[model samples]
Target: MKSTLNSTSESATAAIFLSAVLFCFAPVCSGEESSNKRTGEDIYKQFCSSCHVAGGNTAKPSKPIAGSKVLKSIATFQEYLENPPGHMPYYKTVVNDKSMVRKLYEYCKKLKQTQGA
Candidate 1:
Protein backbone atom coordinates (compact mmCIF):
# COMPACT_ATOMS: atom_id res chain seq x y z
CA MET A 1 0.00 0.00 0.00
CA LYS A 2 2.81 2.40 0.95
CA SER A 3 4.58 1.77 -2.37
CA THR A 4 1.39 2.41 -4.26
CA LEU A 5 0.85 5.73 -2.45
CA ASN A 6 4.39 6.88 -3.15
CA SER A 7 4.04 6.08 -6.82
CA THR A 8 0.86 8.06 -7.10
CA SER A 9 2.38 11.02 -5.27
CA GLU A 10 5.37 11.03 -7.61
CA SER A 11 3.10 10.98 -10.61
CA ALA A 12 1.10 13.89 -9.25
CA THR A 13 4.25 15.91 -8.68
CA ALA A 14 5.46 15.20 -12.17
CA ALA A 15 2.16 16.31 -13.63
CA ILE A 16 2.29 19.58 -11.72
CA PHE A 17 5.85 20.26 -12.83
CA LEU A 18 4.95 19.64 -16.45
CA SER A 19 2.01 21.96 -16.21
CA ALA A 20 4.17 24.76 -14.80
CA VAL A 21 6.73 24.35 -17.53
CA LEU A 22 4.08 24.56 -20.22
CA PHE A 23 2.50 27.60 -18.65
CA CYS A 24 5.78 29.45 -18.49
CA PHE A 25 6.68 28.70 -22.05
CA ALA A 26 3.29 29.64 -23.47
CA PRO A 27 4.04 33.37 -23.55
CA VAL A 28 7.47 32.85 -25.05
CA CYS A 29 5.97 30.76 -27.80
CA SER A 30 3.35 33.39 -28.49
CA GLY A 31 6.00 36.12 -28.57
CA GLU A 32 7.99 34.26 -31.18
CA GLU A 33 4.87 33.63 -33.18
CA SER A 34 4.01 37.31 -33.27
CA SER A 35 7.52 38.60 -33.86
CA ASN A 36 7.19 38.46 -37.62
CA LYS A 37 4.01 40.50 -37.47
CA ARG A 38 5.88 43.63 -36.41
CA THR A 39 7.26 46.02 -39.00
CA GLY A 40 10.62 47.80 -39.11
CA GLU A 41 8.99 51.19 -38.92
CA ASP A 42 6.99 50.10 -35.89
CA ILE A 43 10.09 48.84 -34.16
CA TYR A 44 12.11 51.99 -34.88
CA LYS A 45 9.35 54.29 -33.76
CA GLN A 46 8.96 52.36 -30.54
CA PHE A 47 12.63 51.92 -29.67
CA CYS A 48 14.90 54.13 -31.76
CA SER A 49 12.91 57.28 -32.24
CA SER A 50 13.63 58.45 -28.72
CA CYS A 51 17.25 59.17 -29.56
CA HIS A 52 17.32 59.07 -33.34
CA VAL A 53 14.75 61.33 -34.92
CA ALA A 54 14.49 61.89 -38.64
CA GLY A 55 17.66 59.83 -38.86
CA GLY A 56 19.96 61.88 -36.58
CA ASN A 57 19.97 63.57 -33.21
CA THR A 58 21.53 66.85 -32.14
CA ALA A 59 22.78 65.45 -28.86
CA LYS A 60 25.23 63.09 -30.55
CA PRO A 61 25.93 64.83 -33.86
CA SER A 62 26.24 61.34 -35.27
CA LYS A 63 25.36 60.38 -38.79
CA PRO A 64 21.71 59.79 -39.54
CA ILE A 65 20.77 56.19 -38.84
CA ALA A 66 18.64 56.04 -41.96
CA GLY A 67 21.39 56.78 -44.46
CA SER A 68 24.36 55.54 -42.46
CA LYS A 69 26.58 53.01 -44.19
CA VAL A 70 26.64 50.86 -41.10
CA LEU A 71 22.90 50.37 -41.40
CA LYS A 72 23.48 48.88 -44.82
CA SER A 73 25.13 45.86 -43.20
CA ILE A 74 23.00 44.03 -40.68
CA ALA A 75 26.00 42.32 -39.11
CA THR A 76 27.90 45.56 -38.60
CA PHE A 77 24.83 47.38 -37.37
CA GLN A 78 23.99 44.64 -34.86
CA GLU A 79 27.59 44.60 -33.68
CA TYR A 80 27.61 48.35 -33.22
CA LEU A 81 24.32 48.22 -31.34
CA GLU A 82 25.56 45.45 -29.11
CA ASN A 83 28.59 47.49 -28.11
CA PRO A 84 28.23 51.06 -29.26
CA PRO A 85 31.33 53.25 -29.34
CA GLY A 86 29.80 56.52 -28.19
CA HIS A 87 26.95 57.68 -25.98
CA MET A 88 24.45 55.43 -27.70
CA PRO A 89 22.97 52.97 -25.27
CA TYR A 90 23.50 49.26 -25.77
CA TYR A 91 20.52 47.53 -27.38
CA LYS A 92 21.41 44.03 -26.36
CA THR A 93 18.04 43.61 -24.70
CA VAL A 94 15.91 45.08 -27.47
CA VAL A 95 17.39 44.46 -30.92
CA ASN A 96 19.76 41.70 -29.89
CA ASP A 97 17.49 38.98 -31.17
CA LYS A 98 17.97 37.94 -34.78
CA SER A 99 14.41 38.74 -35.83
CA MET A 100 14.41 42.18 -34.25
CA VAL A 101 17.81 42.99 -35.71
CA ARG A 102 16.63 42.03 -39.15
CA LYS A 103 13.56 44.21 -38.83
CA LEU A 104 15.54 47.24 -37.73
CA TYR A 105 18.07 46.74 -40.52
CA GLU A 106 15.35 46.46 -43.13
CA TYR A 107 13.68 49.58 -41.80
CA CYS A 108 16.84 51.59 -42.07
CA LYS A 109 17.53 50.22 -45.51
CA LYS A 110 14.06 51.17 -46.64
CA LEU A 111 14.53 54.67 -45.29
CA LYS A 112 17.83 54.96 -47.08
CA GLN A 113 16.39 53.70 -50.32
CA THR A 114 13.38 55.99 -50.14
CA GLN A 115 15.49 59.00 -49.24
CA GLY A 116 17.77 58.23 -52.21
CA ALA A 117 20.77 58.26 -49.96
Candidate 2:
Protein backbone atom coordinates (compact mmCIF):
# COMPACT_ATOMS: atom_id res chain seq x y z
CA MET A 1 0.00 0.00 0.00
CA LYS A 2 2.81 2.45 0.89
CA SER A 3 4.59 1.69 -2.43
CA THR A 4 1.40 2.39 -4.39
CA LEU A 5 0.99 5.70 -2.55
CA ASN A 6 4.61 6.66 -3.35
CA SER A 7 4.12 5.88 -7.02
CA THR A 8 0.98 8.00 -7.15
CA SER A 9 2.80 10.92 -5.52
CA GLU A 10 5.68 10.60 -8.01
CA SER A 11 3.23 10.70 -10.94
CA ALA A 12 1.51 13.72 -9.54
CA THR A 13 4.84 15.53 -9.14
CA ALA A 14 5.85 14.75 -12.70
CA ALA A 15 2.55 15.96 -14.04
CA ILE A 16 2.87 19.23 -12.13
CA PHE A 17 6.43 19.77 -13.38
CA LEU A 18 5.43 19.20 -16.95
CA SER A 19 2.51 21.58 -16.66
CA ALA A 20 4.69 24.30 -15.22
CA VAL A 21 7.22 23.88 -18.00
CA LEU A 22 4.52 24.14 -20.64
CA PHE A 23 2.87 27.15 -19.06
CA CYS A 24 6.21 28.99 -18.89
CA PHE A 25 7.55 28.09 -22.33
CA ALA A 26 4.34 28.37 -24.33
CA PRO A 27 4.37 32.18 -24.38
CA VAL A 28 8.11 32.33 -24.89
CA CYS A 29 8.06 30.08 -27.94
CA SER A 30 4.96 31.69 -29.40
CA GLY A 31 6.86 34.98 -29.40
CA GLU A 32 9.70 33.45 -31.37
CA GLU A 33 7.98 32.11 -34.53
CA SER A 34 5.50 34.93 -35.10
CA SER A 35 6.59 37.90 -37.24
CA ASN A 36 4.45 40.59 -35.73
CA LYS A 37 5.08 40.57 -32.00
CA ARG A 38 2.41 43.09 -31.04
CA THR A 39 -0.65 41.75 -29.33
CA GLY A 40 -3.56 41.34 -31.80
CA GLU A 41 -5.36 44.29 -30.24
CA ASP A 42 -2.58 46.87 -30.81
CA ILE A 43 -1.99 45.67 -34.35
CA TYR A 44 -5.64 46.23 -35.29
CA LYS A 45 -5.75 49.75 -33.87
CA GLN A 46 -2.49 50.82 -35.50
CA PHE A 47 -3.39 49.47 -38.92
CA CYS A 48 -6.99 48.24 -39.16
CA SER A 49 -9.23 50.55 -37.09
CA SER A 50 -8.00 53.90 -38.39
CA CYS A 51 -9.15 53.23 -41.95
CA HIS A 52 -11.46 50.33 -41.19
CA VAL A 53 -14.12 52.94 -40.20
CA ALA A 54 -16.45 52.05 -37.34
CA GLY A 55 -13.60 49.76 -36.24
CA GLY A 56 -14.47 47.61 -39.24
CA ASN A 57 -12.88 47.43 -42.65
CA THR A 58 -15.37 47.75 -45.51
CA ALA A 59 -12.82 48.77 -48.10
CA LYS A 60 -13.42 45.86 -50.51
CA PRO A 61 -13.08 42.06 -50.81
CA SER A 62 -12.81 42.02 -46.97
CA LYS A 63 -15.85 43.95 -45.84
CA PRO A 64 -16.24 45.10 -42.24
CA ILE A 65 -13.26 43.03 -41.17
CA ALA A 66 -13.17 44.29 -37.60
CA GLY A 67 -16.50 42.95 -36.45
CA SER A 68 -18.24 39.97 -34.91
CA LYS A 69 -18.80 38.58 -38.39
CA VAL A 70 -15.08 38.59 -38.95
CA LEU A 71 -14.72 35.97 -36.24
CA LYS A 72 -17.02 33.28 -34.93
CA SER A 73 -16.12 34.11 -31.34
CA ILE A 74 -14.05 36.52 -29.23
CA ALA A 75 -11.26 33.99 -28.67
CA THR A 76 -11.06 33.15 -32.36
CA PHE A 77 -10.88 36.81 -33.31
CA GLN A 78 -7.77 37.22 -31.20
CA GLU A 79 -6.09 34.37 -33.04
CA TYR A 80 -7.07 35.43 -36.57
CA LEU A 81 -5.97 39.06 -36.31
CA GLU A 82 -2.53 37.88 -35.19
CA ASN A 83 -1.47 37.07 -38.75
CA PRO A 84 -3.44 39.03 -41.30
CA PRO A 85 -3.02 37.97 -44.91
CA GLY A 86 -0.58 39.65 -47.32
CA HIS A 87 -3.54 41.35 -49.03
CA MET A 88 -3.67 43.56 -45.95
CA PRO A 89 -0.09 44.69 -46.60
CA TYR A 90 2.70 43.34 -44.45
CA TYR A 91 3.20 45.13 -41.15
CA LYS A 92 6.70 43.67 -41.13
CA THR A 93 8.11 46.67 -43.03
CA VAL A 94 6.49 49.03 -40.55
CA VAL A 95 6.03 47.09 -37.30
CA ASN A 96 8.98 44.75 -38.00
CA ASP A 97 10.11 42.66 -34.95
CA LYS A 98 8.06 39.88 -33.30
CA SER A 99 7.22 41.46 -29.91
CA MET A 100 5.63 44.50 -31.53
CA VAL A 101 3.44 42.27 -33.66
CA ARG A 102 2.14 40.50 -30.58
CA LYS A 103 1.16 43.81 -29.03
CA LEU A 104 -0.60 44.80 -32.25
CA TYR A 105 -2.55 41.55 -32.10
CA GLU A 106 -3.64 42.31 -28.57
CA TYR A 107 -4.82 45.80 -29.54
CA CYS A 108 -6.92 44.59 -32.45
CA LYS A 109 -8.46 41.86 -30.33
CA LYS A 110 -9.43 44.46 -27.72
CA LEU A 111 -11.03 46.66 -30.36
CA LYS A 112 -13.19 43.78 -31.52
CA GLN A 113 -14.19 42.89 -27.99
CA THR A 114 -15.07 46.48 -27.09
CA GLN A 115 -16.82 47.26 -30.38
CA GLY A 116 -19.04 44.22 -29.70
CA ALA A 117 -18.56 43.18 -33.33
Candidate 3:
Protein backbone atom coordinates (compact mmCIF):
# COMPACT_ATOMS: atom_id res chain seq x y z
CA MET A 1 0.00 0.00 0.00
CA LYS A 2 2.84 2.41 0.89
CA SER A 3 4.68 1.57 -2.38
CA THR A 4 1.56 2.27 -4.38
CA LEU A 5 1.23 5.73 -2.79
CA ASN A 6 4.89 6.49 -3.47
CA SER A 7 4.59 5.52 -7.15
CA THR A 8 1.51 7.70 -7.59
CA SER A 9 3.27 10.64 -5.95
CA GLU A 10 6.30 10.14 -8.21
CA SER A 11 4.12 10.06 -11.30
CA ALA A 12 2.38 13.25 -10.31
CA THR A 13 5.69 15.04 -9.67
CA ALA A 14 7.07 13.91 -13.02
CA ALA A 15 4.01 15.17 -14.85
CA ILE A 16 4.24 18.56 -13.19
CA PHE A 17 7.95 18.86 -14.00
CA LEU A 18 7.36 17.95 -17.62
CA SER A 19 4.58 20.49 -17.93
CA ALA A 20 6.77 23.24 -16.51
CA VAL A 21 9.60 22.43 -18.91
CA LEU A 22 7.30 22.44 -21.89
CA PHE A 23 5.75 25.70 -20.84
CA CYS A 24 9.15 27.32 -20.55
CA PHE A 25 10.56 25.96 -23.80
CA ALA A 26 7.53 25.87 -26.11
CA PRO A 27 7.28 28.88 -28.50
CA VAL A 28 3.53 29.21 -28.18
CA CYS A 29 3.61 28.51 -24.47
CA SER A 30 6.07 31.31 -23.78
CA GLY A 31 4.11 33.73 -25.98
CA GLU A 32 7.36 35.16 -27.35
CA GLU A 33 6.26 34.87 -30.97
CA SER A 34 2.72 36.12 -30.44
CA SER A 35 3.94 39.04 -28.35
CA ASN A 36 5.34 40.55 -31.53
CA LYS A 37 2.24 39.85 -33.57
CA ARG A 38 0.25 42.97 -34.49
CA THR A 39 -3.21 43.17 -35.97
CA GLY A 40 -3.76 45.07 -39.26
CA GLU A 41 -5.57 47.89 -37.55
CA ASP A 42 -3.01 47.99 -34.82
CA ILE A 43 -0.19 48.44 -37.32
CA TYR A 44 -1.97 51.25 -39.14
CA LYS A 45 -2.95 53.06 -35.97
CA GLN A 46 0.56 52.84 -34.68
CA PHE A 47 2.51 53.82 -37.79
CA CYS A 48 0.27 55.36 -40.42
CA SER A 49 -2.61 56.89 -38.52
CA SER A 50 -1.01 60.28 -38.06
CA CYS A 51 -0.27 60.71 -41.76
CA HIS A 52 -3.21 58.79 -43.16
CA VAL A 53 -6.43 59.39 -41.32
CA ALA A 54 -9.46 57.14 -41.25
CA GLY A 55 -11.01 56.67 -44.72
CA GLY A 56 -7.51 57.29 -46.05
CA ASN A 57 -7.42 61.05 -46.03
CA THR A 58 -4.00 62.62 -45.95
CA ALA A 59 -3.48 64.63 -42.78
CA LYS A 60 -0.57 66.41 -44.49
CA PRO A 61 0.60 66.95 -48.03
CA SER A 62 1.58 63.29 -48.36
CA LYS A 63 -0.48 61.05 -50.60
CA PRO A 64 -3.17 58.86 -49.06
CA ILE A 65 -2.09 55.26 -48.82
CA ALA A 66 -5.58 53.84 -49.15
CA GLY A 67 -6.36 52.89 -52.77
CA SER A 68 -2.88 54.06 -53.71
CA LYS A 69 -1.10 52.21 -56.49
CA VAL A 70 1.67 51.19 -54.11
CA LEU A 71 -0.79 49.34 -51.86
CA LYS A 72 -2.10 47.18 -54.69
CA SER A 73 -0.03 44.24 -53.47
CA ILE A 74 2.15 43.24 -50.58
CA ALA A 75 5.25 43.44 -52.76
CA THR A 76 4.70 47.06 -53.79
CA PHE A 77 3.65 47.97 -50.30
CA GLN A 78 6.82 46.51 -48.87
CA GLU A 79 8.95 48.20 -51.48
CA TYR A 80 7.41 51.59 -50.79
CA LEU A 81 7.64 51.01 -47.09
CA GLU A 82 11.33 50.29 -47.33
CA ASN A 83 12.18 53.08 -49.76
CA PRO A 84 9.39 55.54 -50.33
CA PRO A 85 9.82 58.49 -52.65
CA GLY A 86 9.82 62.13 -51.55
CA HIS A 87 10.18 63.08 -47.88
CA MET A 88 8.52 60.14 -46.14
CA PRO A 89 11.01 58.49 -43.82
CA TYR A 90 11.80 54.80 -44.19
CA TYR A 91 9.94 52.46 -41.83
CA LYS A 92 12.54 49.77 -41.47
CA THR A 93 12.04 49.19 -37.76
CA VAL A 94 8.38 50.16 -37.56
CA VAL A 95 7.30 47.84 -40.39
CA ASN A 96 10.37 45.68 -40.34
CA ASP A 97 8.81 42.27 -40.83
CA LYS A 98 6.83 41.24 -43.91
CA SER A 99 4.02 40.02 -41.66
CA MET A 100 3.82 43.44 -40.08
CA VAL A 101 3.75 45.09 -43.49
CA ARG A 102 0.99 42.70 -44.57
CA LYS A 103 -1.06 43.75 -41.59
CA LEU A 104 -0.78 47.38 -42.63
CA TYR A 105 -1.63 46.44 -46.21
CA GLU A 106 -4.73 44.51 -45.16
CA TYR A 107 -5.90 47.44 -43.07
CA CYS A 108 -5.46 49.81 -46.01
CA LYS A 109 -7.36 47.45 -48.29
CA LYS A 110 -10.22 47.18 -45.83
CA LEU A 111 -10.38 50.94 -45.47
CA LYS A 112 -10.44 51.38 -49.23
CA GLN A 113 -13.24 48.84 -49.63
CA THR A 114 -15.35 50.23 -46.83
CA GLN A 115 -14.92 53.88 -47.76
CA GLY A 116 -15.70 53.27 -51.48
CA ALA A 117 -12.18 54.19 -52.55
Model 2 per-residue lDDT tens digits across residues 1-117: 999999999999999999988987875665554444445554455676665655565544355554445455544544444466555554444344445544554444445422324
The Cα local distance difference test for each model comes to: 0.74, 0.55, 0.72
Instruction: Please state the error at residue 37 of candidate 1 in Å.
Output: 1.7
Residue 43: error of model 2 in Å? 5.8
Q: TM-score order of candidates, best first?
A: 3, 1, 2
Best by TM-score: 3
**Candidate 2: misplaced stretches above 4 Å?**
1-46, 67-87, 113-117
Q: Which stretches of candidate 3 lie above 4 Å from their native place?
A: 31-37, 55-62, 94-96, 113-117
Q: List the residue pairs that clash in candidate 3.
A: none
Winner by lDDT = 1
As a TM-score, model 1 comes out at 0.61
The alpha-carbon lDDT assigned to residue 3 of candidate 3 equals 100
TM-score of each: 0.61, 0.36, 0.68
Question: How displaced is residue 49 in candidate 2, in Å?
Answer: 3.3
Better structure of 1 and 2 per TM-score: 1
In candidate 1, which residue pairs clash? none
Tens-digit lDDT track of model 3 for 20-94 = 997888776665556256698887777777767774545443466656788778888788888877756677765
Candidate 1 vs 3: which has more TM-score = 3
